[model samples]
Target: MNFKKCLRCGCFFASEDSVCPSCQTKDEIDKNSIRNYLANNDTPQNAESLAFQSGVSIKNINRFMETKEFSPLKNSFK
Candidate 1:
């Protein structure tokens, strides 16, 4: 099996995924928080604002955008 370093935690993981399981879980939580925030509020927000409100890093938010994990706020990022 090929072992690779996790992108988020920098820990070695024996898998093809960039982020480890732990980071993946955290990422899900962050994404959920951002989704909830968007669902509750009517105004559009940029990545920086979402990161600040959701306590997730700006980089992660950008990654989410690239992956299209959250479609509702896809165009909200500037």
Candidate 2:
């Protein structure tokens, strides 16, 4: 089956569902929210370095990356 991730909680589930189990209790944003989140975040490497230096958890950073909500680094893989 094809898979589409939940924009609210970043959980991959049955796309037919109206909401993700994790974010079902809270308000869920539409496609616009996801685009905005991606644009607002995902800064440059300098910011990522600063966040890391300031003690942001690797897990959280990675989680954000997977969400497609965070665009912290443009050329992160490079």
TM-score winner: 1
| Candidate 1, run of 10 with poorest lDDT | 68-77
* lDDT by residue for model 1 (1-78), tens: 999898788899898887898998988888888778877976356878888877789888777776746654667556
Per-model TM-score versus the true fold: 0.78, 0.30
Against the true structure, candidate 1 reaches a TM-score of 0.78
Q: Rate the local accuracy (lDDT) of all candidates.
A: 0.78, 0.49
The worst-scoring run of ten residues by lDDT in candidate 2 lies at 26-35
The clash count for each model shown is 0, 3
Model 2 has an lDDT value of 0.49
Residue 51 miss distance in model 2 (angstroms): 3.5
Clashes of 1: 0
